[model samples]
Target: MAMAVAAGCGGGSDSGDGDTVKIGLLASLSGTYEAVGTEQRKGFELYLDTHDNKLGGQKVELSVGDEGDGPPTAVPAATKLVKKDKVDVLTGIVANGSYKAVLPLVEQAKIPLVSSNGRPEVKNVDRLWHTAFLSDEPGAAIAEHVKEEVDGPVYAIGPDYQGGYDELRGFTETFKKAGGKLANPDGKTKWTPFPKTTNFMPYFADIAKSGAKAVYCFYAGKAAIDFAKQYAQSDVADLPLYTAFVTEGSVLPAQGKAAKGIYSVLNYSADLDNEANRKFVADWSAKHDTPPTTYAMASYDAASVLDKAIAEASKGGKEVTPDTINKAIDGLGKIESPRGSWEFGKTHSPVQKWYLRQVRPDGKQLANVMVQDLATLGD
Candidate 1:
């Protein structure tokens, strides 16, 4: 496909030298996480559409790469974006592995890398901004809740990857600190399926017989869908299920009835009470024919960050360059986000609110209803 070019003029628009701020988006457009990648892209596009496709008075161009779900494909795609496409800025990662692979290139180029979705294990990097939550924050938040609510051991499971391992560590460490014990402290109950796992019956059977009070899991995209459906159909369906990133946004639309009553932790919810969230939900639905997912929310926030930085960089008719944009973001304080107001922390990841939500019916659609706002639970 051709590069997505948004041309318009106003305020500090790209004018002299025929400059355009090209944003390179890396996502798994055709892999298991396609739903997630699509939602993120939609969110960024929605922001541009509402702003008439202009950032800081300059026109914007989005170049996309189908980075699949891992780094082997992602590194090359990101390399092409930076080396050949010569994009001015980079964003829109959907997986941790892909983010790790492409980060060195961005750091070497000194181009601002705004991560829209991937929540890597590392924190604090120069010229890199994480508009999304870290991989561990939601897991830690859930662990805190699990400690207070669940009376017995909490079992854990995740896909076997960097994201999975990071999320588990987040939950386990925090849960232990809160005096919670693992179902199998020897790590016997912890399960890690291959990345492309579709059949979850075997795992569910193990979980059913594991004699755990509740289960803590980290799964996203297609894997999340399959696991939720299989768990709901299994004998252990009645047990309390808690997870991070498993029951929100694009995952829910596909999960449908199986998603009901699942307690999850996230920064944004469809039913989060706030003016910004209310307006964002309505606007996104009107444009996309669906409610905005957390992935979408992150992408929208990334776009907003870019818009603010670009506007600052273009001040006094100054040419917008990578260095200028980086400086603008570095100086940025709190961003008024749809999830809520948040600011970049010392680690460049968002220090934002974490909501404990339960999936329930809201009229004809399933929505994540906020149980409580566990405010600002990130590094």
Candidate 2:
């Protein structure tokens, strides 16, 4: 597949010069997470298209790379972007493992990474910023709400990976703290083997036996489609389902009726009533048949951040270098986004509101309808 490129006005030159801002977008364009990667690319590209392919009042040269599914594929791609392409900034990692794998390259190059997705916990975060929520935040934001809504224990499950571990841990820890219980026989979150566990019947059978009042899980891409479809036909189909990423727009079309009525917690929904979101949704709808996903929204926000940071760094005749851009990002306050207005917190992640959403019919199509405001998180 051909990679998308947004050319700068001037001839191709290194970002060290003032003519262009070189941005490397490393995402899983192939393998299990292809759908997510596609959305990430689309979101970032949409922002560029709207802004005349410019950032900080300068032309942009975007280089896209495939991170695939994990570190083996991601590391090499990252190295090429950082060393060969010499991107001033990097963004768009779909998986947690990929994000962690590329850290050393980012640090060595001293380039800022405005990550569109897959936020992982790390000790050194001086050069990292995420448009996406921390893996744990989605679950933690909704744990108390789930506890209040469900009468009894909730059975938690997710793919076996770093992202899964953080997501489920957030729910379990916060749920227990909120005076809730788990229905798992071992009192632990169940882990399905990543990218290998296509068949979830055994897991559903186990959930049937766990005597849980509801089920909560975190799955995305193809896995989400399989899980949602299988869960709908399972013996425990009547049980309420609460989740984070499973019912998102990227997978909702394939999930179809199976995803209906499922509750999810996320930072963005296409139906949100705000000036920025309305324009965003309208623009997205103009190009596609389906609504925008959180993946796309996050990537779009990454572009917005760079736009402001680059502009800020360029002021007062300051050079728009990566270090200067990084400092500009630190000083950016109250960013207006499709999700709403938010500002980066001390963690260099958006301190934003989480919303309760339900998959419901909008006219003829299904959408993640905004149910209510859940909480303001991301400290």
Best by lDDT, which number?
2
- Candidate 1 per-residue lDDT, tens place, 196-246, comes to 678888877777777789989988888899988988999879889998878
True-structure lDDT of candidate 2: 0.88
Collision pairs in model 2: none
Cα lDDT of model 2 by residue, 1-379, tens digit = 2233443322223644446678899998999899999999989988888887788787788888999988999999999888888888999999999998899899988989999885988887788999989989999999999999999999999999998998998889999999999999999999999989999999999999999999999999899999999999999999999998898867898999999999999999888889989988888888887789999999999999999988888887666778888888999999898899999988999899999999999898888899999989976
TM-score of model 1 (CA atoms): 0.94
TM-score of every model versus the real structure: 0.94, 0.96
Sliding window of 10 residues with minimal summed lDDT for model 2: 4-13
Query: Which portions of model 2 miss their true places by more than 4 Å?
Result: 1-18
Q: Which segments of candidate 1 are over 4 A away from where they belong?
A: 1-3, 6-18
**Model 2 deviation from the true structure expressed as Cα RMSD, one decimal place:** 2.1
Residue 351 lDDT (model 2): 94
